[model samples]
Target chain A: MMRWTLKSLGTQIASTLASAGGVAGAFLFVLFLEAVFLGESKQIVAYIEHMEPDIWVMQHGVSNMHMASSFVWDWKLDAVVEMDGVEKVTSILYVNTMVRAGDRDWFTYVVGLVEGDKRAGPWAMKSGSASPGPGEIVIPALFAESSGAGLGSSVSVADKKFTVVGLSLGTFSMANSVAFVSFGDLVNILSAGGTVSYGLVDLEPGSDAAAMARRIEAEVEKVSALPHPEFVRNDFNMAMRMGVDVVAFMRVIGSALAVAIIAFTALVQVSRRRRELAIAKALGVTNRSIYFSVVLQTVLITTAGYAVALALALGVAPMISLFVPEVTLLVSTGSLLRMGAVALVVAVIAAMVPAYMVNQVDPLTAFQG
Target chain B: MASSKLIRADGVSKHFGTGHTQVRAVDGVSLKIGYGELVLIMGPSGSGKTTLLSMLGGLLRPTQGRIEVAGTEITVMKEAELPDVRARLVGFVFQSFNLMEALTVEENILFPAQLIPGGIAAARPRARELIERLNLRERRDSLPKTLSGGEKQRVAIARALINEPPLILADEPTGNLDSRTGQEVMMILFDITRDENRSVVLVTHDPRVEEIADRILWLEDGKLRDRKSEDHSWVRDPVCGMRIDEWTAVHTWERSDSKYVFCSARCKERFVEAPDQYVNA
Candidate 1:
C-alpha cells in the first residue's frame, strides 16, 4: 500500500520534486547553522582548549580567550608555580595584531610561549618545527593557507620582519589566523616588563585540577583560576551568548518552514488521493491500514530527504572549510544522529493531520461518487 | 439452491437531519433477501436506492430498524464491529467501478479477502482462480486507469466474490459502462447468484437490470414498494395505489375488524368517504 501510494504521487513529478526540495532545503539550512555554531565554539579557544594545563589563571573578569584581553603581573607566575599542587608552570601572552605579507595583510593572534616549555605551546606540527626560535614565528596551517605564508617567508609585524619557520596543525581561530612567536620577541613587540597573559599550571600526579585551581586563586590576587575544562566550557558559552545564537535562531526558522512545506505536501497528497482511499475502505481496507500507509510514505519521503541533505552537506563542508580556513564546518556522528531524530519527528508530526483526514473518509463516498 | 434468508431488514428508516430539514432517505423499509436471489432495487435519482443499500450493507446505521446480515444483528452492532461484518459477510461493488487507482487488477480482487483473518494466505489462491475465471489474467498487474470499463466492472465482480461472501451489495455497478458491457456485468452477477448460491442486492436506475432480477424491489420517497402483493407483505391503498407498509403506516382504516393501511391521511379520508367505489375498482 505504501509503495502504491508513493508511486501514485510520484507520477506528479513537479510536486514531488518541490516536496523533496523543501525537505532537503530545510535539512541543509539547519545543518549549515549547526556546523557554523560548532565551528565558532571550536575556534573560540582553539589555541588553549587542548593544552596540557591543569589550572589556567587569567585576569579576574576574563571568561573568553580571543574576545577579551587578560593580563597578570610577572610575579604571579612565581607564586602559582610555588603552589604544592603545581607540577610545572608556563606563562603565555596573547597578542592580537595584523601581519603584513607583501601586498596582503592578515589579521592574526600571536601567542607568546615560554622558552623550552612545551606546555601551552603548539605541540603538533605539519612541517618545519613546533617551536619558533628568536626572530622566527610558527604559523598555523590555516593562516599559512589564507595569507599565502610559507616556511622561510618573511611576515612584517609592527614594521619588524620575522621569518615563518614552522606550520602548526589544526590551531585555527575564528577571530583571526593564529601564529606562535617566542617569549623574547613577544616581549619586545608588546614592551612587556612585568605583565603576562596568564599562567598554565600543570598539576602533579593524582592532583585534582580543581584543587590546584583553588590553591592558585587563594595565593594569587587580581587573578581568576579555573580548571582547563571549565575554561574551555566558559569560552564556548561566551561565544554562544555573544553572537552565535543567531545561528540557532536561523535553525528554528528553517525548521518551521520545513515543517510547513512537508505538511503542505502531505496534505495535498492525501487530499488528492481521498477518492482512492475511500475506495480502499469500501473494499474492506481498515482505517488503520490507510493511516499506516500514509505515515509510512511520509517516513520514506523524510528519510530520502535526510539522505539528500546529508550528501549535500558532506559535499559542501570541505569546500566551505577551504573558503574559511580559520574555522572548520565540523560534522560528527553525534550531530548526524541529532539531525536524523529531528527529521523523523518532523515526518511523524506532518503525517498526523493527513492520517486523520484519511480516517474520516467515508467508504460510502466511493460508491456514491 | 436451498432457500435460506441471507439478509433480513425490519422497519428500517434512515433519516439524515433533524427538524424540518430532516431528509428521510430510507424510511420504514422491510426486506428479506433469500440465498441465490438476485434482487435488483430500482428507483429514480434521490429515490433512496443507494441509501437503502448502504443501510443493508452496514455502511450506515438506520434511524430506526433492525438489520440482520447472515444471522448477525448488524443494526445493534457497534461501529467497530461493522468492518468485520463488511469484510466477512458483505462485499460491495460500486457504480464507478471504484477500484483503487493505486493498486492493480489482481490487488483489487485480492483486497476484500485480505481483510479477514489468515485471509492473505487464503486470498492468494482465490485471487489466482478468480483472475483466470474472470478472464482478467492478462490485466492482473494493470492499474484501474489502464483497464476498459467492461474490464473494470469484471474485476469488481471478481473482487465481490473473492471473499465468497454470502451477500453482495452493488450500487449501479454498470452505470459507467456501455449497454452491452452493462449486460455482461449483470450476467456475471446473475451467474454468481446461481452458481455460488449467494444473495445480491443491487441498486440501479437502468431498466436493463430488470432482465437479471429474480424480484424487482422499488423504492420511492425512502419507502419500499413491492412489485408483487401476492403474499400481502405490502398492501396497495385503494385510493392512492401506493404500497403501504403495515409496520409503519400512520393512516389506516378498520372494516369489520380487518385493518387496511392507506398511503396518506388524505387517501384514507377519500377511501373512508367512499370505500366501496375504490375497493371494488
Candidate 2:
C-alpha cells in the first residue's frame, strides 16, 4: 500500500507555471488582436450603424466605406428622404488624409457629418467635447496621445490648421485614427461643394430593411441601397480578405501551443512517477484507481496553470491601452468563460496520454530490488 | 493434531515462453500449509520460489492445476477478481521494504486497511495502535526515505499486518537487513504467527530463519524437493547404499514420480539395473 501526497510539489509547480505562462500569454496576445479587430470593425461602420439608419444609398459600384469613395449630389439627400418607409435622411462624408502634429504625420480616417446630428457622431467621448464645430476637430484618444496633441492643440490636415477640441476612445479603423469634422468644413477643405460620400436613410419602425433597401434602389438612379448590417458585414469580409485572416490563423496556433505545453508537462510528470504508480497498483489498488489518480494530477496541474493565466490576463488586459489607447482590451465574462472552457479541454486532453501510460505500468516492478 | 489447511496447491505449474525456448519456472508441485503454521521455502536464486509464492497469493496465475486460498480456487479466478482476493485474504512483505517514499509511516501502514469496507474509519485507530506497538509513534509522521533500515522494515511489517489477512507471504523480508536486524524481524514475524494464529509462509535462503519456521520446503530447478533437512549434508541415493552431496551431485535419476540424485554413475547404473527394487524400496 502506498500513500500519495505532494512529495514533488516543486516539480508540479514548475510544470504548471510553464504551461500556464504559455496559455495566458497567448490568450493575452489573442485578446489584443481581438480588441484591435473589434475596435477597427466597429469604427469602420460606427458612423453608419450608430446613425440608426436602416438603409444606405451609395454610388452604384462603391462596396465599402474605407477603400471606396461614392459621391451623390446634395439634392439626393432630399430625394431619399421622400421615399416610402423613410423616416429621415442624413448626409455623411468620408475622407482619408495625412494630419501633421508637430514633426509627426499620421494617415487619418476623417468622418464629416452635419452639426447637431445625433444620428452620426463620436459615440463615446472619454474626455473633451463630442461634436466638433467649424474649424475644430474631435480626434480619437489614441491619435491625440500618440501625436502628443491634446485638447486645444492644433493639427494641420490637408494644409489647413484645425484645433483639437475633443477626444473619442475606441474610434479607429484598423491602423488609421479617426477624427470627426463638420460637413461644412469638409466641403471647404476638400473643395467638393454640393456633393457627399453617401446618403444615410432611417426607416420607420416595423419597416422591412431588406425591402426598403430594394425600394430605395429603385427610386434612386445610379445608386445602390443596402441594409446597414449587411453593409458592415461586407466591409468586415473585405477587411478579412485583405490579410486580416492572419490573426485568426495565429489564434489557432496559440491554442494548439497551449494544449501542447500542458500535454508535455503531464507526460513528463507521469514518466517520473511510474514507480510510485506501480507500487500503488501492487498494493491491491485497482488499475482504475491508479488511472484516475494520474488524470486528477494532470487536471489539477492544468487548472493551476489556468488560474495563473487568468490572473495574468486580468492584470495585463487593461495595460493594452498604453499601446493602443483608442482600443480598450475587453475582458468580458463570455471571453473569460471561453478561455476557461478551452483550458479545461486542453487539460483533459493532456491528461489522457499520461492516463494511458499509467495503465501500462506493471505492478511487479515494485517487487524488483 | 490435524489443522485446517489455509493454502492448498494441487499440481500447480507456471511456465514462460513456448517451443524450445520455454521455461518452466514452477514445475508441478502439490503441498498444503496448515492454519497457524509458519513454513519457509528455501532455495537458491532462480529456483522459482518467488514465482510459487506469487501463485499462492494470486498475483501470478498457475499454468496447470488449481490453488485454493482460504477455500477459493483463486488460480481459476478472473483477473479483476484477484485484487479482491489478495486484499482480503493475503498480505505480502518484500525484501526491499517497499514503503512509498511520499507517504508518512502511519499512512503507509493504513493504506491497505483503507481498501476494505468500514476500513477508513477503523484504519486510523488501528494505525495508531500499530505505530505505538512497533514503537514508531514518534516517527509516524516521517516519510520512508528518512527512516533507518530497521525502522523501514518495522513499518513494512505493520503495513502487512494492517488488514489482518489470514495468510501472510513474505519474500526475503530480511534480505536487506543486517544479521542482528534480520533476526529481530524474523522473530517479529514468528511472534505474529503465534499471537494471531495466522498462517505465515516466507521464502528465504537466510539460514537465520530456519529455527523460527515450523517446516522448511526445499526447491531446486523449479521443482519441490525433500523437506525439513536439519543439516545440509548427505542425501541418500536410492540406487546404491551411498550418501551424496545434493548441492554438488551430477548424476541423477528422473522418474515419473520423483527425482533421485546419485554421487556416481555406478550407482545410477545399479539403479537402472533394477528399477523397482531400489526405487520402491
Candidate 3:
C-alpha cells in the first residue's frame, strides 16, 4: 500500500524513449533496404508465382529472375506441353528495361503477355482489362503516380511506344515494378522471333511439382525447370544478398545506440542519487528490495519505449508515401519483434551497472556532522 | 530486570583494518539503555560514539562481543538479516535529513513502512498522525528541497517513528540546523521518548542537549570514561593548539571521533579543510 515515488522517473522515461527511438530508426532503415532490395525481389516472385504455376521453365544456368536473364528456343515449348501431367503451358516474354513516360523513366520488369491467356498476366487491374494487346501496356498502379502516367497515356519500352491500357495492382514496390505488354511487341523489341523468356507450366491436380520439374530438366535440353516455391525463395535471396550485410550492420549500430543510451541513463540515475539509496538502506530497506525496484523500472521503461518505436514506424510509413508514391516501407511484425528482443536486452544490461553501484552505498556515510 | 532494558551491550568492540594500520573504533564498551529513556551519547569526534550507536542499532556488527535490542541478540545475527532487524527494532535519523528529494513529506514519512507489516497502506493513519503531530501538515505535500532544515528533520523524525520501532537511533540529528532550529528538533526528539514510551539514542556533540537526556555516555579515544564535575581544566585544541574556554568557545567542533575548540572560524575551517595535515603535524 506504500506509494513509491522515484526521483529518476522522468530521466527514466526520457532514456527509454531515446533508446526506443534508436531501435525504431534501425527498424525503418531495414525496411527501406528491404524496399530497395528484398522488396523488389518480393514483387518479382509474386508476379510469376501468383499465376498458380506448378513449375517455371527458364534457360539453363539461370535460376532466378531478379537480376538474371533467361531464354529458351520457341521449339522447347512443344516438348514441355507434350510431357505427362502438363495441364497447360503459358509462355511469357520477360525483360528488365527502363520504361519512359513523358520525361520520367523507371526500371521496369516488362512481362509480355500472350493473347487469350490469364496466367503470367496482371492478376488484378485498377482499370480496364488484365490483358494488354499489341502496342498496348499495363503498368503497376503506383507507377502511374510515380511516372505521372495513367491509363490511356503513352509509355515507351525498348524505344517502342505503347499506350497504357490499364493500371495493375499488387505489382509495385520501391525496389522495382512490373509492366504488362503485348507478346509480339516485346518479341519485336528484342527482334528474337524464335525464343521465349519463361515457360510457366501448370501441373494436374495432386501432382508433385518438384518431381515434374526434375522430369522436365532430364527430358529437355538447354532448359532448366524449377519448382515454383523454390524459384521464389531463390529469387528473394538473390535480391536481398546485396543488402544483407549492410542491413545487419545497421541493426547492430541501432542496438548499440539503444544500449549506450539506456546504460548511461541508468548510470547517471544511480551516481546522482546514491545517497538516496543509502538513506533507504539506513532506514532498513533491504538491498534485494532496492535492486528489484531498479530492475523492474528499467524493464517497464524499455518495453514502453519499444511500443513507442513501433507506433512511430507504423505512423511514419504512410506519411512518407504521400510524397514518394513509389516508396513502400515493408514494416513487418517480425522485424518489430526483433527490435523488441533487442530492447529487452538493453534494459537488462542497463540495470546491472547501476544496481552494482548501489550495492556500494554505506548508510553510515550518509550522515554528516 | 533485564527485560526492562531496551538495549544492552556486553563488552562490544569494533576494530577497523589490522596490524599497524589497525584502528579500534569502539573499544569494549558495555552499557544498558532502559525503555522510554532519552539517552545521549556524547563524545569528541573520534570517540566511537557513532560506531557504538551503529552497533546498538544493528547497522554495524561489533567485531567482538554482542549487542541485544529489545532482548534479541543482534551482534551474533548474520549480516544479511541485519537490515530486517534494524527495520523492525530500530529507526534511524541522520544529520543530513536524508529524505528522498522526490517524495512528498507524507510519502517520505511512510517510506520505511515498506519493510514493516501492513506496508504503506496500513501505515497511512500513523503517517497522518505523525504529520499532524510534528507540525508538518502544512508541508505534507512538499518535497524535501522545498522544505526548511527544521521541517526536514521533523519529517525524518516522523519517518523514524512510522514503523513504531521500540528504539530510535539518531546520529547528529541537529548537526545541520541553526541553534534555534536545533533546539527545537532536540525538544521534538525529547518528546518522542515520553510520547511513544520508547528508547531514543542520540549521538551529538551539542552541549545544549545534556539537560534533556536521562543519561549521558561520554566517549574518548574509542573508550567510555567517567568524569567528575570539578575536574575541569583549561585545554588547547589538540589538533589546532588554540586555547578556548570550553563553556563559551563558539568554535567548539567535532571531527574524527574527537572534539576540539578553535580560537577563530579560520582555525576551525583550516582544521576541517585538511585534518590530516594538522593532526599528523
**Can you write out model 1's per-residue Cα lDDT over A174-224, one digit (the tens) per residue?**
556678888888889888867898788888889988877777778788789
Candidate 1 lDDT, B1-281, residue by residue in tens:
43258888999999988999999998899989998899988755688888889888888889999998888889998877788888889888887887777678988787777678777677898889889888899999998899998899899888888888899999888666655576688888888888889989888755555667899998889888876545334677677565545543445789977787764445667778988898789
For residues B1-281, write the lDDT of model 3, one tens digit per residue: 44778888889999999999999999989998999999988766677888898889887778898888998898778878888888888988998888887788998898888887888889999999999999998999998889998899999999999999999999888776755687799999999999889899998856667779988887878888764445344567555463444743446678768877754444667678887887788
> How far off is each candidate at the interface, as Cα RMSD in Å?
1.9, 2.5, 2.4
Model 1 Cα interface RMS deviation (Å): 1.9
TM-score of each: 0.80, 0.77, 0.79
State, as a TM-score between 0 and 1, how close model 3 is to the true structure. 0.79
Instruction: Give the TM-score of chain B in candidate 2.
Output: 0.81
lDDT of 2 by residue, A302-358 (tens): 567667767766777678656645554545565568667776787778777777787
Candidate 1: stretches off by over 4 Å: A1-14, A60-66, A82-87, A95-108, A113-169, A180-192, A202-230, A240-244, A323-327, B1-4, B17-22, B228-281
Model 2 stretches with alpha carbons more than 4 Å out: A1-13, A16-76, A80-88, A95-108, A115-138, A144-174, A181-195, A198-248, A322-327, B1-4, B227-281
How much is the lDDT of residue A39 in candidate 2?
A: 51
Cα displacement (Å) at residue B125, model 2: 3.1
Measured with C-alpha atoms, the lDDT of residue A187 in candidate 3 is: 91
* Model 1, position A3: C-alpha lDDT score: 55
The TM-score of candidate 2's chain A against the true chain A comes to 0.77
